[model samples]
Target chain A: MARTQGSHSEITGPRVREAAMRLFARHGFAAVSMRQIATEVGVQAGALYNYTPDKQSLLFDLMREHMDALLDAWQQEDPGGTDARARLEAFTRFHIRFNTRRADAVFVSYMELRNLTGENFAAVTELRRIYETRLEEILRAGQDAGVFTLAEPRITAMAVIALLTGVNTWYRDAGRLKLDEVETLYWDMVRRLVGG
Target chain B: MARTQGSHSEITGPRVREAAMRLFARHGFAAVSMRQIATEVGVQAGALYNYTPDKQSLLFDLMREHMDALLDAWQQEDPGGTDARARLEAFTRFHIRFNTRRADAVFVSYMELRNLTGENFAAVTELRRIYETRLEEILRAGQDAGVFTLAEPRITAMAVIALLTGVNTWYRDAGRLKLDEVETLYWDMVRRLVGG
Candidate 1:
């Protein structure tokens, strides 16, 4: 029975996640209760339990999935042949693309992180650290190649991430600039930041 | 008797706000109850009624004050005889200074803003818009004066605001870089973003 329930929940998981992500992003994880999420998802609160063990687990699953996808997307790119500037461009493009489409997810990923605890918090934070460390590694490589002039590659990477992630908080498909235009603008800033 | 109670409540208003901000920021507005805030503040739950008419008012007041102080701080700066770059310098400095000192309030201002209602929500949002519009004006001046080469002044302004406001999320007093150093690092990024 447990296996059947788990399998059935897996089938409806994405729908539950989508509904929860919107509510969590809109109301915040701490403010939103499971019943509200179920209502939003067009299910009874009890039926929602068939999807996730609890509200916190539901939030954690969305964030975990987002991070995994982000890492996978970045990893799949063959930035090997790209020079420092080109690689930076790829990073900027990917950063903007992933963040823009996942505004609610990104908002929860960035802000509701504190709602996670113990092992869950550690796992999420570790993924975030790994992602940030990858950017720092790129900055380090660029500096090693004598192409970037940043004084502190690590902090600069953090600043860039902060700025790039900032895109999600405000970007709208209907907003003033197209995604390409915003990417170009960010690229300009990144290029100038390290004197590329 | 009610007038004396009101005056007494006035004295505790800021303390109540402090309690509410901390709780709302830590546990989120929906998760925290009046009893919790009262317990945190060493007052009876009923006594909190002497100050905040409701939990939403407490949050609204905090958000409003944070935005107002931010606006007031920017206005106090004498941007006279300053070019776009110099004004940008002052802007970065002020942003870091204010956000670092009141990270909680700043976080509440950004994160819990949706909690406000009716007139309160509109008022807080208007103040925030005023600040962003002012920054855009400065960026536009920079572009017109040929000191900046951004494609869109307004979009660039939003990015800068995002980059700076994001500092409050990760900044800590014990962090390796001092506040002054962090401010300079961000100021450099802002300068480069505008082709300075």
Candidate 2:
């Protein structure tokens, strides 16, 4: 029984998350049910409890994982150097690329924040603030070096992130501009915004 | 009977819309039901049908009205001179102010786009494009007059709008910054972005 349950868990865990993410992105957290998720995952509704305690937990887990992956990916992609300009450019391109590829997760993360319980909301909010701080630190470093001009580093960081993430709204791979072209266009704008 | 029905609608129509907007903004369109909206409006579920055919119509009407009001407000607020720089500044401040004032409508318009049916989505998308074109025209005029440096005016317009609309996510009337100060900060960023 232990061996059978272990195998089932391994196979269904990722499937459950993928299904939840897809459904939540499509219909939103408040609208989607455990039954609907189970239907999507090809599992009995009772089987889903073995994986997640409730829909809120599932939503929180998805949001937390999205943030964790984003931070992790940025860490790996960080062109570790003292040059703030280069780091900002790297960040611009990286954010647009990462978010466009995971549009569903990005949409879910942004749209479902109100549905989270207070404690869960706080946890996800902190994770998001940590991610935002990554860019804020870069901006501050640049300010310290006199490499960037800004009235407020923190606000600039938020604006820059918003600009980059906005790409996911209308960007299509089949659209007129290629991904690199989009990145370069945004990079140029960011460079100007920061006076880099 | 006709006079009584007219009087009831005159009072209940706006209430129904207000409740729907508040609920949809809080819980998302897909999660909200006409019954729930009616309950919030102090009406029967069946009475909601007297106001809107269905939830999709309500969502679409809310979005359309938001966009229409946005466009109309900008039209009224436009500086309307040949100076692209002045016009762009007006747009930056105007967008931030207007959107922040109607945070719930803005949230619903963006977050519930996926919930809109195809025809409704297209209608809203067209309206949004028209609004974006307002900014794009400013960018293009700036570029034409050598007042703004832009690789793509359309993309720059979208970026600026996103950056301005982002203020709604964090701005509060009781926050440290006054509305005018926030507007000036964003206007400065917009100037830098456009090379004005």
Candidate 3:
């Protein structure tokens, strides 16, 4: 019963997450069943208990994992660099890449957070706010440095996030638009958003 | 069964739609049972068929009605006759007003269309495309007339829609941010986006 997908002896966690992500995306979070996810993972419904406490945990697990990966990817791609324009572009590329590549995860990350319980929801909420705040701070720094021209950094940040997230709603893995092309369009828009 | 929440005559059409709106927004379109909607409307499950032939029809009926009202509001407000910036501002205000007033209907209108089937889906799809295209044409006209400055009119229109739609994910009937305040913030961002 102890299973982790890539770990030494555990395959349960990742498998359950994979099943949950697919179901949650295709059907909204509240509609999906634990039994359905268990079936998809090739485990009995009871076997899923070893991996998650309940459906809400399964939902949070997918969301938190995606956010962690997102933050990690950003940091790994640009470790300890704080140039505003560069950071903005990096953020643009990272968002487009991660969001487009993981459409289900990104969709659930945005739409299903409300389903999480008090503490679980709090953690995800705080992390998301921190990510957004850092982006705004970078924009403000750019404004001060005279590299980015923007009005209302916080509003612009929210607009950028909304615009970038829209990419996932229509972007198909094999869609006509390349991820880089989409990324470029957003960068252009955000640059303009910030008066770049 | 009949409903008269506002200026409606009977509970059948409006009542069915009202119930569907709440259920769809709460549980989503695909997950809500026709029987449940019937119960919410105070009618026998079979009697609900008098108004809508099926669940998809019930869903599409509410969507088309919402969009129709939205289009009517835009026209009644004389959104078209104004200058580019005014027209854009009209759009910002109209969007917030419609979505806020009919929160449940607007939620389903934006998020639950894919659940519609056959002619029901096509009708909603075409109307939606037509509405969005109207915005795109405005941006294009503004850009061509030199009143607006946007690198890409089509993308700008879509981004504006995204910003407006993002309102539903967080809006409350009574929140720290009032609808007018949110509309103002969006208007500013939209003007910046369209180079107003």
CA RMSD, predictions in order: 3.5, 2.8, 4.3
Top-down lDDT ranking: 2, 1, 3
Q: In candidate 1, which residue ranges exceed 4 Å CA deviation?
A: A1-11, A42-47, B1-11
Model 3 misplaced stretches (Cα beyond 4 Å): A1-11, A78-82, A149-151, A173-176, B1-10, B171-178
Question: C-alpha displacement of A190 in model 2, angstroms?
Answer: 0.4
Q: How many residue pairs of model 2 clash at the backbone?
A: 0
Per-residue alpha-carbon lDDT of candidate 2 for residues A98-169, written as tens digits (9 for 90 to 100) = 999999999999989998999989999999898889999899999899999998888888899998999988
Ranking by TM-score: 2, 1, 3
Model 3 chain A: weakest 10-residue lDDT segment is: A2-11
Give TM-scores of chain A for all candidates.
0.90, 0.94, 0.88
For residues B2-113, write the lDDT of model 1, one tens digit per residue. Answer: 3344445543777888888899889778789999998888767778887778888788888888888889888998384549778878888988888889977877777776
Q: What's the CA error at residue A25 for candidate 1, in Å? A: 1.5
Worst 10-residue stretch by lDDT in candidate 1 chain B? Answer: B1-10
Model 1 chain A weakest 10-residue run by lDDT: A1-10
* CAPRI tier of model 1: medium
For candidate 2, give the lDDT.
0.89
TM-scores of the candidates in the order shown: 0.90, 0.95, 0.87
Candidate 3 lDDT score relative to the true structure: 0.76
What's the lDDT for all of these models?
0.81, 0.89, 0.76
Q: Name the top TM-score candidate.
A: 2
Model 2: C-alpha RMSD to truth? Answer: 2.8
